[model samples]
Target: MADRGSTELTNPLGALTLDQLRRRTSMKWRRFPPDVLPLWVAEMDVPLAEPVVRALTEAVALGDTGYPSGTRYADALAEFAAGRWGWRIDPDHTAIVPDVMLGVVEMLRLVTGAGDAVVVNPPVYPPFYQFIVHSGRRVVEAPLGEDGRLDPATLAPAFRDATTGGRPAAYLLCSPHNPTGTVHTRDELSAVAELAGRYGVRVIADEIHAPLVLPGAEFVPYLTVPGGENGLALLSASKAWNLAGLKAALAVAGPAAAADLARLPEEVSHGPSHLGIIAHSAALTEGGGWLTGLLSGLDANRLLLAELLAERLPAVRYRPPEGTYLAWLDCRRLGLGDDPAATFLEWGRVALNPGPEFGTGGAGHVRLNLATSPENVAEAVHRMVAALD
Candidate 1:
C-alpha cells in the first residue's frame, strides 16, 4: 500500500529528475560527487516560497532597498504568532533584531548585570553559553534530567539555589531544546514560570525551531503560560522557511518586561536590510502552505533516517526527536575515537554539527540535520555505515 501520509521529497514520485538534481548541485558551494551529501548546515535545498521570491523581486523593482523600519515586519510577525502559537503580542512588544542569538544577547543585557548569574540547561544550544559570557555575566550550568524531558520538578531547585545568594537575573530556556529537540510541555513551563516568579528571575525562551515541529507535536508559547509575563521570547521564521541569511528575527516582550528592552540603543531596530523585512513578512503572511509542505517533507526524512540508523548503526543510540529538523545521535557506543562531527567528516565524507557545540551533555553525540531531501539523508547515512565498516 502506498503511504499516503508520507511526503518524502526524495521519493521518486515527489523528487526532481537526476538531471534537475545535478543542476541544483552545480548551484551549491561543494562540487563533491553526487553521492556525497552535505547535511551539516540547517539550510534546505528547497526552492524559496513563491511569496518570498515575489516579495524580494517586488522590493527590487521599486528600488526600495534601504534601511528597514519596524511597522510592517512587526505586524506580520505579530499576526503570525497570534495565529500559529496562540500568543497575542503587540507590535510594540516586537523588536526586530539581527537574528535569534543576537536577540538573546540583547535581551540578556536587559535583565542581568556584569558578573551576575544566569542559569542555562546543558546539552542545549552552545550559543547560550557564549551570549551570557559575552554579556559579562556568569554562567551557571543546570543540566536537564535524563528521560529526554524538561522536568521542572527536577530543575526548579537548581534555579532556586543559583538565586539564593543573589538573584540569578535571567534564565535561557530553549523551547524545543536543541540537540535533544525536546518540546517543553505546558505543565513543565508552568513550573518554570512559578520558579521564576519566586526568584524574580527573567526568562528568555528561544523559539526559533517552533514552526518546524513535527505533526502531532504540541507547541505552547512560553509567554502564554502563567507568569510568562515576567520573561521575553525570541523567534525567527528563518528555520521554518529556510531564510537564515535574511537576518530576520523578533524579540517579544511581555508588558512587565518591556521596560527592560528600553535600555537598548535606538539603533538596534534601524540598520536591518529591506529584503529581510520583505522576506520575513512574506513567509509569515503568505508562506503557510509552503511551510506545511516543508514540515511534511521533514517528517518523512526524519522517519527514514531513524529506521536507517537503527538498522545500520545499532550501537549508536538516538531516540526520535519530538520536534525540529535535527537528530541527536549518541556516538559514544560506536567509540568513533573523536567527536562524531569530525569523525563523520573524515570517515563518511559528510559534515555534521558536533555534540560539544550543544554543551557538555552532547559531548559524545553529533547533530544530524535531516531537513534536506530524503535521498540526500540516505546517502549520508549510507556513507556513515560504509565509513564505520
Candidate 2:
C-alpha cells in the first residue's frame, strides 16, 4: 500500500504496475484478454485505502458479518458532505439503498408512475437508459450541447414533453456526469431546478461521482440550489473508494421532498450489505487522507492523458474532464467509423467503451477510463496510435 497520508504528493494510481493489476480478477482487468489493455470501465486501478482495509479486516476477524442497521452510513456521509462540500445533510432525511442506480430507481418510483417519462441528458451514462426502462418508465432525451454542458433550451423541451398530458415525470441528473466528466456548476444546477419546477418534473440526481471532482473544478450538489427543495440525490463512497462489490448508497431527499422519500418501501432498506456499510462508513469518516491522495493522483493522470493524446493522437479531440476519471474522446477525425471503440480493440488491443451505447450524440466517439497509472494511460494511447498505422 502507498502512503495513506493526506499529502498531495502521494501517487495512489502509480502504486501498482500492470502485472500486479492483471493478477486481480476485477471487471476492469479480467474483461479483456491478457494481450489487451482494458480502460473501459469506471473501476480505479488502485489498492484499497488503509482505513477501509482495516475496518473490513476487523469486522471479518470478529465474524461481524450480519444485517445492516442504524444511521452510521448516513451520518458518515453527512459529515463528509459537510466537511468536504460545506453542504449540510440531515441524516434523518437520508435512506440507505443497495447502490446508486437502484436508489435512483426507488427515487423515481416516488415521483413518477409506470410508463411516465424520465428525462436524461445524453451522450450520458449508458445505464441511465437501461435501469430507467427496466424500472417501467419511458426515456426522454435532452442531449447535452456540443460542448458537453447542459443546455436549458434542450432541457426545456424534454421536460415539457415528458410531462405531456399532466403525467408525473422525473429527470435523472448525473452530477459530475459520467463519461464526459463535466461537473455541474451551481448556476447550471439552479437553471435545471428552475426548468424542472416549471414543467412539474421531479429531479433525481445521481451524484456517485461527486467525490471525484478534480482540481480547478467545483461540484455543485443539485439539492443545494434554488428551487431544488423538491429534488432527491443518490450518493455513495463506491466510486471514489472503488468499493462497488460492497454495495451500499444513500438516497437523500431535499427539504420539500422528504415526504415523497418517506413513501419508499421499508423493504428497500434490507438490500444493502452490512459489511459494505461498515466499509463505506469507515471510508467516509476515516479515509479522507487517503481520498486526498487518490484525488491528487487522478488529477495528474487526467492531464497526462491530455498530453499523450495531443502529442501522438492530435486528431482525436479530448477535453480534459472537470471531474470523474473518465475521458470522452471524439475519434471521428481518425476515420474509425461510428463505433471507434471496436476498431481500437480489434487493431490496437486497447479496450475503450463504445460511445454509441451512451445514446444520442455518442457516435464516432469513445470513453476512456483515466483511473489508472500514468504509464497505462500513455500505453493505451500508444496502442491507439499504432492501430491507425
Candidate 3:
C-alpha cells in the first residue's frame, strides 16, 4: 500500500492508507479487502529483487527442470556463506536442502535415534518441537525465562536430569529467537555450546532469520562462537528475502559435524528444487543491497509499532525487536492470556501469529510481522488498539 519512500507517520504504527493498502491486497489472495490487514504470516508484500527474478527467469528459459545431479548447488551456497557470514564452510561440508525444517530433520537423523532426548528453548519456532516429535525423539523443554532469554542455570539442571539415565542427543538453537526477537549474544550461545557439548549433545542452530537484525544490533552466527561449530547451523536467504517458495537452505556442518552432512541419504539430496538453487544463488550473491534496504524498512516499522503501542495500547509491553521482522507483544496484563492471537483475529480483524505456537512461555503473547509497508503496520496497530479498547 505504501511505497518505500513514504514519510514516517507520527501516529502509532504509521501504516498505509486504506486505498493504497487495498491495491496491494488485490494482487494477492482476495479473501480480505485492502483495509483488512494480514500481519500473521512471515511473508512480506514487497516485490522480489530484479536480480532474483531475472535469475529464476533465466534458469527456467534453459528448460532443464530435471533433478539436480550433484554438488554444484552446494558449492554455490558454500561460496555465499563464506562471503556473507565470514564463516568458512567447505562446500564439501555444506548440503543443499529443500527447507530449514527438512535440514533439521536430517540433522536429527544424523546424530540421534528414536527415544533420545533433544532440548529446545520454548516460545520458539513451533516447528522445532514438531521436528523432534516427527523424528521420534523425546521433546525436552528448556523454556526461556520471562525476559526471553535461555537460562543456563535452569537449563543445566534440565540437561542433567534428562540425561541422568540416558544422554540427550541434540539441542535446537534459535539464534535471533523467534516470537521473542532477542538475538542470542555470543556469550549466550557460547554458554549453550559448552553445556550441550559437555553433556554429549549436539546443537542445531536455526539461523534462517539472520539477515533481518535491526540497526545497532549485531547477530552472532552460532558457529562463530566458541565451540559453536561443534554443532550445525541451518540457514537460508528465504526468510530474509521473502523467498520461502524457493525451497533452498543450507546446513553448515562444523569441523566435527561435517560427517553428519555427508551421512544424509541420497534421496534427500536429490529432492532439492532446481529453481530453488538458482534463486538462492542470486539472493545470496546479489541480494545484499536489497536486503539492507529491507532491514532499514523493518527498523522503521519497529519504531512505528512501538510508538503506536505506547500512545494507544499502553497496556501492551513490547521490547524493541533485535532481529527478524517478528515483534513479540506481551499482553498478559490485559487478562487475555489464554489466546491472544485468536482474540486479535476476532476483534482486531488482523491476522497475527499466535504466541502459544512458540511453546509454554508464549501463552500471553502474539508475534506480529513488521516487514510490510509502514501504512499497513500503522493500520494494523490502529485496529488492534481499537479492538482492545
Backbone atom clashes (below 3 Å) for every candidate: 0, 0, 8
Backbone clashes in model 1: 0
Per-residue lDDT over 99-121 for candidate 3, one digit per residue giving the tens place of the 0 to 100 score: 99998998888888888888888
RMSD for each of the candidates: 4.5, 2.2, 4.8
Expressed as tens digits, the lDDT of each residue in 1-389 for candidate 1 is 11112232322212444456456533232545555556665666677777888889998999988888647878877777778777787887778888888888888878877787788888887878888898898877778887777767556766776676775578889998887878888898888898888877889999999887887778888988999986899988888877887877888888888887667677777645668878988888877777777777877877888889888888888877778888888899888754877777777888778888877577778888877677777888888887777
Q: List the residue pairs that clash in candidate 1.
A: none
Instruction: Please tell me which model should have the higher TM-score, number 2 or number 3.
Output: 2
- Measured on C-alpha atoms, candidate 1 has an lDDT of 0.77
Total clashes, candidate 2? 0
> Over the stretch 91-208, how does candidate 2's per-residue lDDT look in tens digits?
9899999999999999998888899999999999999999999999999999999899999989999998999999999999999888899999999999999999899999999999
TM-score of 1: 0.90
